[model samples]
Target: SRSKNSNKERNLIRAFTVLDAYASKLSMPENAKEHAAYIYRKAVSKDIIRGSSIPSMMAASVFAACKQLGIPRSMNDTAKVANMSKKKLSRTYKRLVKNLELNVSSFEADYVSKISNSLSVSEKTARLAGKIIHDLKKEHLHVGKNPIGITAASLYLSAINYDEHVSIEKISKKTNISTVTIRKMIKLLRPFASKYLKSIDLSV
Candidate 1:
């Protein structure tokens, strides 16, 4: 009898192919191959880095690799070098965290900063949005829920509350969330939006 190939087997083969391409592109140091393999293995084990989005995963993985190796590339620089959209990559990074169940919050900061940097806002604005999202999480807004939906909602609300001048359409376009959902989230936050706005510094 012939053996059957499962989805997992196909995914594994694709994963290896992606890793090979990534390693070739980076021309990573000889010793770095081991580190790359380690990270790739972890990503595969986690099952979040799909072959279709391997480039995005590779971008995040390279950032992770750089941090581990103390290579020090700025988020903006990495996004540029990777030629990936910062906002889309940020969303992918969040998906990676959810899939890996990682407790690390620093990557969240990078996500927010990437959005701010992309929107040409100050880092402070991003930090403020991060704070709002953190506070919301503590209040159980994210309880028993879809985190990506909650996060996209929270970020949209935060951008408006901070008076960032980025229209809802633009946020929808950037975050890839539906405009209807954005409007709904905005309306839901309306009563509290003004209150939140009063507390954050809007310079920049």
Candidate 2:
């Protein structure tokens, strides 16, 4: 069984390489990276990694681990960092979850920091955008909605009020969300903005 052991070792090395590279690229925390490595090993034990590309499987493992850990990284961000198409990454992620029976807990996302850092919005504006998200959660308006779209819309609203000059196209590019969806989310958010964030006039 020496040959089989050697092949397994090589696969482990390759998986580690992909995981490490993507983790570094995404700035994943130490705990998250370790958890991803563990998930990769579990997937290997389940024999689900055989048909898929190693990079895709490893990246999918990371994504699943992040979801389990409530990390704020989205599929779009992870796919971009892994240098793979979102569709491929998403498919691989779904396969991993189904085959491994991974428990990916649902959690509220903190997309303001991610989008703010990506688009270079001011810290003050990011805080205001966070407050917007908090307000939505309190009002239960964020349930059954796309969190990233809501966050993008909130950041856009806060940026304009603060005169930060970030555009919808840029947010769409960074978020992999459509401008149309962002605009729709903005419309839903405007009434709340008018109520809580009174400094900005939504009557435009």
Candidate 3:
């Protein structure tokens, strides 16, 4: 019993170490980190951690926490920080979500601030991007879409309207979303662009 307890303790310490490393790299807030730790503990209690590598489990836990808390970190960002493949991280994340019965939903608007901050867009541009996201959301356009791609596309459109000169490649690099994905999202947003712009202009 003593040996078994020690092994469990060691595994927990190892898991938490991995969690802290990636969480720090991603600059997760303390509350998010705590939430992730709680999730990890729950996973252990449920034996969902069995046979999964510590890094993958920790990465999935933090990713789950971010989604639950509506943080803007993408799976690509978390995978890179965890030094794991996006495919593997995604697989692990899905497993954790299923096993934990977690209700994980995030929106494009939730990501506007993070992507805009990373790209250093002006406050006006950020607000415009946010408005673009929300306006589209009202129509349920963002449903079944990649949040990062949609958020990036909105920011790109906002920058153009504001004559801010941020490029698609720059947004792609900052967001770890593909230029192709961003372009596809842009195409979807184009028809609505004039309307969004008109609203912004009217407000200004």
Candidate 4:
């Protein structure tokens, strides 16, 4: 019985150590960090951690916490910080979500504000992006798209509409998306956003 208890402690330490490493890199809020640790414990109690490696489980926990907390960290960003491949991290994340049946908050239009702030975009552009995302969501245009890419696309279009002189490459860098993906996202979304941008004559 003592050894069993000791094993649980060691597992917790290993899990927290891995979580702390990635959380520090992301500068995650204390609440989100604690929630992740708590979720890790739940996973252990459910025996969902059996087949998966500890680091992968830790990565998934923190990633889920970010989603639950509505943090704007991308899967690529999570992959980078966790020192794991994106595919692997995503697979683990999906498993955790499935087993835990976690009810993550959906990304809101206001999430654009967080993304814009991280990229240092102007407030005006951020508002425009929010409007764009809100409008797009009205018709379910963003349903299957990657959140970071879609947000980046909206911000890029908003900047152009506001005559802010920002480039897709720049937005790509800020959001950690490839320029190609942002371009594709913009291509589809631009038509829908055109009517919105019409009100502002940025050319002036």
Best by lDDT: 3
List candidate 1 stretches off by more than 4 Å: 1-110, 144-149, 188-192, 198-204
Candidate 2's residue-wise lDDT over 1-204, tens digit each? 999888888999989988889999888888899999999998888889889888989999999987775565778989998889999999999999999888775633446677788899899888888777888889999987877888889888888888888888898877767789889999988766655464864532
Q: What digit string (tens of lDDT, one per residue) describes model 4 on residues 73-175?
A: 6788888888889999999989889999998755655457667887788998888887878778889988867877788888888888777778777777666
> What lDDT does the true structure give each of the candidates?
0.57, 0.83, 0.84, 0.81
Residue lDDT tens for model 1, 1-204:
223336656655675576566556565554454655566557766666665366677667665665444333445655665678888667765676567654444344555665556566655666666766676666666454333334445566576555766766666555545677656655543444445676653332
RMSD of 1: 13.1
Give the 10-residue window scoring lowest on summed lDDT in candidate 3: 195-204
TM-score for candidate 2, residues paired by index: 0.57
The TM-scores of all predictions, comma-separated, are 0.41, 0.57, 0.59, 0.59
Q: Candidate 4 has which clashing residue pairs, if any?
A: none
At residue 174, what lDDT does model 2 achieve? 79
Whole-model lDDT, model 2 = 0.83
In angstroms, give how far residue 91 of model 1 lies from its true place: 23
Q: List the residue pairs that clash in candidate 3.
A: none
Winner of 1 and 3 under lDDT: 3
Ranked by lDDT, the better of candidates 1 and 2 is 2
